[model samples]
Structures are given as structure tokens and as C-alpha cells.
Target: MPRIFTAIEIPADVAQTLTFLRGGLPGARWIDPENYHITLRFIGDVDVHVAHDVASMLDSVNRAPFDLRLDGVASFGGRKPRSVFANVAPSQALTDLQAEHERMMQRVGLEPEGRKYTPHVTLARLRDSSSRQVADYLSERGSFRSAPFRVERFVLYSSRASTGGGPYIVEEAYPLAAIPAKRAI
Candidate 1:
């Protein structure tokens, strides 16, 4: 069985920008820039057959490339601040793509994802940072935003099952349709 998930790769330039957010907070285990990604769906350990079905079904997704931006910074686990992340600006295309993946997983017999989809690229896993520490950090860098980046493809990544934030391997990639050029009137 392999642990896998679908996600949009962050461009190198954007990843470099994100790297600046490293350090400052104690107990923050910064994620490697190479592992930064906006996950579409997390499909936990599955048999070979289900993995093959997921890979095959993902190729059937039909959607045009869309732009996404990292708009702000935030943390999860309000009081305890379990993790920090770069917020992704809302995009219907992104939401639709994620929803499609959710539906596809169910079609493959996986349970519906229990949590509401909150799209973000995690920056670090907090071990003992308090709410004040997280709040102060956010206050200082809350206005961070990245230039819009085109998402031309999404990929299926496999990772060793362990605590999250990892050395993920791209098992396969699925490209989105190119946006058609406008015709001059």
C-alpha cells in the first residue's frame, strides 16, 4: 500500500519567496521549499488497485489552467497553533478542481473528506508555539502576497506515512487545458 495525494506544484520563484518566511518562531519546523504544494485531496494508504484507479481517473479531469496567489499568512489549531501556512486566494477553478478530486475519490470508494477544504501551502509544523507567538508572527507578515502564478498542471505525489510535511515524490502529473486566446473583433 502507498500513501498518496493530488496537488498543484508551486513554481520555483514562488517557493523561493515563501522561503523568506522561515525562522523566527521557536518550535517551528520549517518545511523544505521543494515540498511546498497546494494539496487537492489526500488519499491515505491504499491498495495497488485503488491507486491505479485514482491515477486513471485524475487524467479524466478537464479544466483550463488558472491563476492562483498566496494572499496572506495564518495558522491552524487556533490556541495551540499546530501549523503555519501561506494562504491561497480564493479561486473558483481551484475549488472546482478540488471538489472534482473529492468526488473522484468517493467514486473509488474512499470516505468523504471529513473537513471542509481550506486550500493552503503549509510552511511549518508547530510543536509548542503558543497562540500569542502565532499571533505576533501573523501580525508582522500577515500582508504577504505573491504575484499570481499559473497552475498548468496538478500531480499525484506519494509520501512515506509519517508525521505530515514531507519529502514527497511526484508519481504522476495531469495537465490542465491551455486557456484559449481571445479572438480580435
Candidate 2:
């Protein structure tokens, strides 16, 4: 069974910017910008029928296009940094969309993620790091922030390999309603 997850794809321009941010971190395997995404929920491998059910149920989520801000840099694993990611700011629209997605998935048979959802786009996965190292890194860049961009759609991805850079196929794309051109914050 493929490792499946629901996510929102990053735009090419944003992806390129993230790609350039890679490097300098030893023992880390950075994610290719092309693979950057905002995971709404992750549903582990399941039978073909379940995949279909998830896809169908996800079809019910109604998320309007909203802007997202990707700012700041951070790592996971405290002393032993296991991964790193760029935090995504959660606007009410973004939060509501993810909640609706999770709720719809549960109705269709996928388990809830349990933890409160904090939006972020993963930038890399660390091979190893000490707790001190992780803490130090965060302290250095904790204030990191970025300009926001419009989110037009989200996707369903299938992780087909463990290469850390293989094919994460976009099995489906769901579009949010277009934002009004005149609307301003």
C-alpha cells in the first residue's frame, strides 16, 4: 500500500525560494522544492477501496482560496534534530479548511490526526542532531517569517518510495473558490 496524505502544494515561485534556502545543514536531507506541500492530514497505506473512499470523501471539502504566509525556519528533535520545516501561518480560512478536511475524512473512515494542526511546509529532514544543537538552531532563527501568498488548491499525495526524494504523486487536486479581486485585508 502507498503511504498516502492530503496536502496543499506550494507554488513554483515559493518552491524555488525554498530550494535556494537549502544547504548549510549537515546530516540533513533537504526536500526538493518541487515536493514542498502543506499536509492537511496523513492517512497511512490502506486497501485500494479505502484510498478511493478517502478521495471521494475529500471531494466534499469546500475551501476558498486564501493567502498563506511562510515565514521563519525551525528544526525538530531538540538535541537530536530529526527534521526541519518552515512554519506556515494559519489564517482562519486555512484552519477551517483543514478542520473540514479532517472531519470529512473521518466521516469517510480515516482517523483524526489528534494533535492540533499547526500549518507548516517541511523544508528538510535531519539525519541526527543533539538536543543542544536543535535548541541552538531554533534560537538563531526563531523569528524567521515570510511574505504570504494565495492558496488556490490542495492535493492528495501518494508516497511511493523511501528514497527521501522519490515520487510523491499528486493523486488529486482540489481547487478553492477564487478570491474576489477587489477584496483587500
Candidate 3:
């Protein structure tokens, strides 16, 4: 089984900017900058056949490339502080692309994602970090922002079953265009 998801890779410059926020927070297992990505859809654990179907289905997603910015920082577990992430500035293009992925996955017989989409890139996995610790971390870096970057493509990624903030492998790649190319232009 492969734990799969579809995501847009963060550019190297942006990842370098994100690296500055890595240390200081207690119990924070910071994710490597190389693994930084804005997940479009999480397919979760699936068997080989379903994974193959997911890859084939995703190739049909036809959405244009668009700009994205990372703005602000936040914690997921409100009080308990399970993880920390950089919030993705919401854009209609990102939302539509994500929804299209959702629709495609369902068409391939995968379960719909239950959580409402809140676009973000996980920066760290929080374990024993306290509420005060989390709050303090957020406060210091709350206004963090990155230069906007173009999302020219999205990828099918695989990761081991573990507390995420990954070691992700790009299983396949798919390009984006202003419109789906019709029979090779």
C-alpha cells in the first residue's frame, strides 16, 4: 500500500525562506524544506490497484497554473497543538484545482476528504509542545510571508505511514495549462 496525495511543489527560494522558522519551538519536529508542498488532495493509504487508478485519474485534471503565496503561521490543535503550518493564501485557482482533484478521486472510487480544505503546508509536527509554547511560536512568526510563486505543475506523491511532514517521493508529475490541451494542440 502507498500513502498517496496530490500536491504542488514549493519552489526552492520559498523553501529557503521557510527554513528560517525551523528551530526554537520545543517538541517541534520540523519538516525538511525539500518536502514542502501545498497539498491539493490527500488520497490516504490505498492498495496498489487503487493507487494506479488514482494516478491515471489525476492525469485528467485540467487546470491552469497560478500564483500562490504563503502568508502567516498557525497551529492546528488550537490548544493541544498537534502540528504547525504556514497558511496558504486562499486563491480561487487553488480552490478550484483542489475541488477538481476531489471530484476525480471520487470518480475513481476513493472516499471524499472529510475535512474542509484549508490550504497550507505543514511546517512541523507538534507532540509535547504546550499551548503557551504553541501560542508563543505563532505569535513570533505570525506575520511570516513568502514571495508569490508560480505553480506550473502538480505531482502525485507517496510517503511512508508516519506522523507526516514528510520524506515524500514524487510518484508522477502532471503539467498544468490555461486549458487542457486538445489532442496535442
Please state every model's RMSD to the true fold in angstroms: 3.8, 4.8, 2.2
Ranking by lDDT: 1, 3, 2
Q: Point out where model 2 deviates above 4 Å.
A: 135-143, 161-166, 178-185
Evaluated against the true structure, the overall lDDT of model 2 is 0.77
Worst 10 residues of 3 by lDDT: 176-185
The 0-to-1 C-alpha lDDT of every candidate, in the order given, reads 0.95, 0.77, 0.91
Cα error of candidate 3 at position 185, Å? 16
TM-scores for every candidate against the unseen true structure: 0.95, 0.86, 0.94
In terms of lDDT, which candidate is strongest? 1
The candidate with the higher lDDT, 2 or 3, is 3
Per residue, candidate 2 scores C-alpha lDDT tens digits across 1-185 of 77788888888888877766666666668788778888888887788888898888877665568888887877756556778788887588888888887887788777778887878888878776565655665576567666678888888899875866536899998888844566577
Q: Which stretches of candidate 1 lie over 4 Å from their true place?
A: 178-185
